[model samples]
Target: MRIAAATAIAIAIGLAVSLSSVVHANEEKLDYDHQEKWQSALDRAQSPIDIVTAQTVRAEDNEPLGLQLWHTQAPIEKAEDNGHAVQVNTHATEAMIRGRHFTLAQFHFHAESEHTLDAKHYPLEGHFVFKAQDGRLAVIGVMYQVGDGNPAAQAVIDDLEAKDGKLPQPSIDIASLLPNQRDYYHYLGSLTTPPLTENVEWYVLPTPVTMSEKQMTTFLSHYPHNNRKIQPLNGRAVVHHQG
Candidate 1:
């Protein structure tokens, strides 16, 4: 009995040490302000820029923005706190933009919005990250204002409220979260978060979605301010898609 107890203690200590090493190895905590520390973040074409509507031009090609979002009944694969914000990873749902197919990888929220419209910031912003077949990325930004209760937003909030860390499988209709109108401001930018890789295509919808005060409160309870400061435009032409 004594030998068994000693062996159990040794095993537990070994496990703890292993876990600590794993965490330290993966820890890369670059705060929103510290983006300059990374070379990629210093690029002139960085993202989360303010959309100046007056300066924006219509696309030369005038091709329709052709947004095809799949409404899947499949349950959300996972929902994670991510320490910054609540992120929901979906399955069996995808979106296409201008003939390029992109799989819906995940969607996350930011408080006070990363991108602003005419220099006005919304209460919340949702970024739907999509990965194309050729390893390119396209992010859809949806701004939200405080108003009536939104069932779709509530569904995601409920999952976060129930579990702070990683949530089990949750049923959420991601399509319902988007605005009815798909008019957007298109531009070439970088990722809002770090590594801040350039060449990412951003499509920011002008219409704001509705979320209740209670829902906003719940989200703020976790992340009061996770938005990064807007970056410079650097001669990038923002194309306006009416559709």
Candidate 2:
């Protein structure tokens, strides 16, 4: 009996040590330098979007934006990341503005956060990509900060339970998670991903929603360093509303 108990203890200790090592190794692999990589990647992507004055944007004609609908199982053609941990590229659906009969082609998440205004880091950031019939692209960026509880964000995290690296069915209704105000910061930028394509119309919400510290930590656990540093303004204009 004594010998059996000693053997069990030894095995348990060995298992713990092995598991610890594995966790450390994974963390190391996730340590990516955001600035260097993003700069190089952005340089490669220089496609510019047709400039349209913000004043010319027709609010009445724009389609009423809806919650993002996602499906992780629907064949992810691409999957990669920057300073962030995981970005499972998968098919998704999103409603375009009224005049724009468009839909979201893909969606992904960023850790720690990205798309900073001036100089601020949000807890997390989710990017939904919409492609127009004419090949124009508009990216809706939802900014998240640590706060109370965010049901919308929780929905996404819950669905991620069984999926870490692999894409899983996404719990959506993301529109509700967004700020009530449609006001945003519009700019011309490149996709913040690999082989960065410059053909991107960035629609960044000026207002941000809240998430719990626990929730933020949950994402950080999977991706400790998610931001891709910051990109230069490059003589670009960042337009925001005065309201």
Candidate 3:
């Protein structure tokens, strides 16, 4: 009996050591320097800019404001906690710009928004990532403030709690999550996350949608700060468009 107990203790210690090593390896893989890669070389068009609203250029009157999102038709499939953020996936979400078709592939949120409005940060920001058939990318950014709690948003948090994911990316309707006033600020930028891919189109809404304190708390609990720091505008133009 004594010999058996000693063997059991040794096996348990070995298992714990193996698990600790695996966790450490994963942490090393995730810990990366954005500055060492594409960010340093292609620094001109980085995203998460502080939009000085006063300085934004007005779109020409003759220009066509071609951005359109058919969010009502979008049906979410599943949600996953992708370490960095909770990413909600959908097979299809449609959009159109200047006669070009795009699909909203997935969306995720960042706490304490990536972009700032006249140097002010919001509680949360959601990025709806869209992709054109030819591989071009456009992202629609919506800011969330503390106000009347959004039911659809709340439903997402509830679903995440039920599932117990490492992160909570809500599988809610994109339309239900957006602000009624879609007036937006548009520009050319890069992906906030790495590879830091450039030449992406960005449309950030001026009017913010509301989520309650509880919703904010739950999201922050998952990721206290996932947002990238603000990059320089670098002669880029941000246009104000009427929704």
Per-model CA lDDT versus the true structure: 0.72, 0.52, 0.68
lDDT of 2 by residue, 130-177 (tens): 665655566777777888787755655665565455445343454655
| Candidate 3 lDDT over residue span 17-51, tens digit each | 22122111122223333533423336777888999
Clash count, one per candidate: 0, 7, 0
Question: Which parts of model 3 have CA positions greater than 4 angstroms off?
Answer: 1-41, 71-73, 164-171
Clashing pairs in 1: none
Best by TM-score, which number? 1
Better of 2 and 3 by TM-score: 3
Name the candidate, 1 or 2, with the larger lDDT value: 1
Task: Kindly report which residue stretches of model 1 are placed more than 4 angstroms away from their true locations once superposed.
Answer: 1-30, 33-42, 60-65, 163-169
Better candidate by lDDT, 2 or 3: 3
lDDT of 1 by residue, 1-243 (tens): 122232223222222222112111223444656656555534877889999999887754646355778754447855557766677777567887766677877788888899999999998899887776655666899999889898878878767666555554367777777898988888877677655666667889999998899988887787778888889888777878777
Model 3 weakest lDDT span, ten residues long:
19-28
Task: Write down the lDDT that model 3 would get.
Answer: 0.68
